[model samples]
Target: MITEVAQIEVLPGHEDQFEQAVSQAVPLFLGAEGCEEVDLQRSTEQPGRYRLLVRWETIEHHTDLFRQSQGYQRWRALAGPHFAAPPQVEHLYSVLAP
Candidate 1:
């Protein structure tokens, strides 16, 4: 499995708006092929920061979704203006078992 982590810094006073937009946009990713699940979380120590974690079957699947689908564009349109800057995204793979 692959996890895509997106660390976002939202503008002040736009937290709820950003969350709402992400809520609406999540279904697009969740509905795509190989998307296992999606998680949206706020930083406990940072007032205007958020994190988005998306689980995929593989990195290839995640890449294909971004490269071939319109969902990313829609997602950007919905949440782009709320961002203070571009999000920092990282991909991770599990290396240890629980």
Candidate 2:
């Protein structure tokens, strides 16, 4: 599986609104074809910062499939406005060896 981590920065003082929007938008990820799981975490030190973790069957599932779907559009519509800037995203995988 591949894990997609998105660093989201909310506008100053908009943390609460951003969180609410993301909560309502969670289903967009949950209902996607190749998404296995999704989670959102807020930074204690920086209230406006959030980290979104999404596990997918493959990288393509996120980059090619989900990004190209209408769900992506809905996701943006739900929470995009609260963003201070575009989320910075990266993909990761578990290492078999230490």
Candidate 3:
């Protein structure tokens, strides 16, 4: 499986709204094809910073499928306004795990 990590920075004073938006958008990710898991993490040192982690069966499941689906549009619509800037996203594969 592959994990997509999106580093997002919310606009000042919009942190709570952004978090709520993410929560509301969870189903969009969960319902996508090949999506296995979704999670959101906040940076303790920077309240406005967040990391969105989504695990998929393959990289194409994210880049070629989900990103092209209507759910992706809905996701952006729900969470886009709160973004301070475009998120930095990357994908990773597990090398070793317990």
Candidate 4:
């Protein structure tokens, strides 16, 4: 499995709204093909900063499938407004595990 990490910065004073939006969009990821898990983390140092973690069966499940699906559009529509700027995203594979 691969993990997609998206570093998002929300506009000042929009933190609560952004978190709510992410919560509302959870089902979108859960219903996506090959999507195994979805989670969101906020920075303690910077309340406006967030990390969106999504685990997938493969990278294509994210970049090719989900990103191209209507759900992705809906995701952006729900959460895009609070973005201070475009998110920085990356994919990772685990090298070791317990």
Candidate 5:
């Protein structure tokens, strides 16, 4: 599996609302084919910052399939308004798993 890590930044004063939006948006992430798991975490040091982790069966499942689906559009509609800027995303794999 591959992991997609998204560095999310909410607009100032919209932290709480952004979290709420994420709660409602999670289903869209899970609804995609090959999506294994989704996790959202807030940064204590940065009130408006969050990290979103999504595990996928393959990179293409997220980069192509999910990104091209209607669910993605819906997700953006629900959470896009809370964003401070475009999120920075990176894909990762376990290199030292035992």
Candidate 6:
């Protein structure tokens, strides 16, 4: 499995709105193909900061499948304005080490 992690920083004073928008946006992720799970978290210390963790069957499922789908475009239109800036996203995978 592959994990996509994003550190989202909401604009000052827009935290509440951001959270509300995210609540609405969650369904989009949940409905996507190859999406195993989606988890959203907020920072206790940094009130306007959030972490979005999404698990996919493979990295291509996100970068190629989802990103190329119409749902992603619609999602972007809905959620784009809420961001303070473009989110910092990273692709990750588990490591089992000896």
lDDT of 1 at 17: 96
Summarize candidate 5's per-residue lDDT along 33-88 as a digit string, tens digits: 99999999999999789999999999999999999999899989988999999999
Candidates 2 and 6: which is better by lDDT? 2
Where model 5 places Cα greater than 4 Å from the true spot, the runs are: none
Q: Tell me the tens digit of each residue's lDDT in model 1 across 25-83.
A: 99988888899999999989998999899999989877776637898888889999999
What's the TM-score of each model vs. the native? 0.93, 0.94, 0.96, 0.97, 0.96, 0.89
Best by TM-score: 4
Q: Is candidate 3 or candidate 6 better by lDDT?
A: 3
Q: Rate the local accuracy (lDDT) of all candidates.
A: 0.90, 0.93, 0.96, 0.97, 0.93, 0.86
The model with the greater TM-score, 2 or 6, is: 2
Model 1, runs deviating above 4 Å: none
How far in Å is the alpha carbon of 10 misplaced in model 5? 0.5
- For candidate 1, the 10 contiguous residues with the lowest summed lDDT are 60-69
**What is the Å distance of residue 57 in model 6 from its true position?**
0.4
Candidate 2 backbone collisions, by pair: none
Q: Better model by lDDT, 2 or 3?
A: 3
Q: What is the lDDT of residue 37 in candidate 3?
A: 98
- Cα RMSD (Å) per model? 1.2, 1.4, 1.0, 0.8, 0.8, 1.8
Tens digits of per-residue lDDT for model 3, 1-98: 99999999999999889989999999999999999999999999999999999999999999999999999999999999999999999999989985
lDDT sort, best first: 4, 3, 5, 2, 1, 6
Clash count, predicted structure 6: 0
Give the number of the best model, judged by lDDT: 4
Quote the lDDT for 63 in model 5: 98
Q: Show model 2 residue runs off by greater than 4 Å.
A: none
Pick out the ten consecutive residues of candidate 5 with the lowest summed lDDT. Answer: 16-25
